[model samples]
Target: MIITKYRFLILSIMILFSVKGQSQDKFKGYFEPAIDLSYQVNPKYGLSFGVENRNVIYSDKNMQYTVKQIDLSHFSEYQWHSKYAFGLGVQYRIEHAFDVDEESELRFQEQIVYTPERSGFETDHRVRIEQRLYASVTKHRFRYQLGYTIPLAQKQANEPYLKFDTESLLEIAKTQKPELEQRLGVGLGWFVSSKTTLQFGVEYQLENYTQQLNHELFLLAELGIEL
Candidate 1:
């Protein structure tokens, strides 16, 4: 019986550790601000275009490490009925985020030599993504969206290459590392009148490496007129 109990305890401990090791797939609550413009061509069918910007600040007490995004999203709306709508859109994004800290890793040429001093290590630090999202909106302002962000550009804090295309290498790394820099969002909005509305919402970034952070807080109120 003692041996059986010991085995059970061991199994339980292993299971607990396994669960802890798994990544949490949820975003912490925060504030996100966004704005857009829409032009209504007719009642049933209309088209609109706008830009969305996100600024992400890490909740962790690290001043030097925060992620920010300046994204432009173009959107079109097709009203299927009174309670539903479908939106097709794509986003062009220019983003900047914190990389591995100054001395987290070491030199490419020699182990002990500081990478910065030796100038050998390829510290892939800065990254950029171009993403496309498809959204379906419900009448009460519930949106479910799926998107994929492809890496179009990247740069290290201090590194140079020779005999290779630097831009191409960055693009290649994007695929090799295999990141799904994706987002999922939910929110509520209020309609004040025919020409103006206010919306407030939250978004999440699901990344492969690093602990999943709440990332972006989007709060937006807009004024628009049907055109």
Candidate 2:
């Protein structure tokens, strides 16, 4: 039964990716790599820190692989109930980090997450609001995401899992009109150890979909550790 469910999920994700790929004319590709560390403060509180970097791998205008940005983030979460949690996060981003003319950005975020108990699969619903501050402009964004995790093997060491998520974001700024973006992601993960996990994934993004559509794809790799 578990194997059948896993295959079905994979098939569905492939079909969706195929349809989206055919519908878009052009898209840019990026490679995103990140590492995250989490610490449990108590039963109801936790903290996490992460570093992520993005590189442009394929683009019509710029074909050469280029460093885009590096982000350092910290977040704190409070579990109010067994199935509900609230979080606050902050990020510092260095755009064109390897170049001389780099720019800096600061962002603050607030979020809530809900995870209901399930037998076979795990699900998450998240809502987040962010305030991004740059030198010239500030933007506010709202986002909601639905995510699923399916374990392929029985709960044990070195288990494998599949993850899928869809997110919608709305960005508002004073200088430009509001823009809507949609993201879809599919990933394969492994519990490398009791406190370590590794994941590889691909994500498709559509930016400014409400107006002029811009498509982007990201190849993702992440390592997560709990301490």
Q: lDDT per model, in order?
A: 0.36, 0.90
| Worst window of 10 by summed lDDT in candidate 2 | 1-10
Model 1 alpha-carbon drift over 4 Å, by segment: 1-31, 63-67, 79-87, 96-186, 204-227
lDDT per residue, candidate 2, 44-158, as tens digits? 9999999999999999857779888999999999999999999999999988457657658899999999999987899999999999998888999999999989888866779
Winning candidate number (TM-score): 2
Give per-residue lDDT, candidate 1, residue 190. Answer: 43
Candidate 2: where is the Cα deviation over 4 Å?
1-26, 61-63, 96-102
TM-score of each: 0.40, 0.90
What is the Cα-based lDDT of residue 105 in candidate 2? 87
Model 2 CA lDDT for position 188: 93
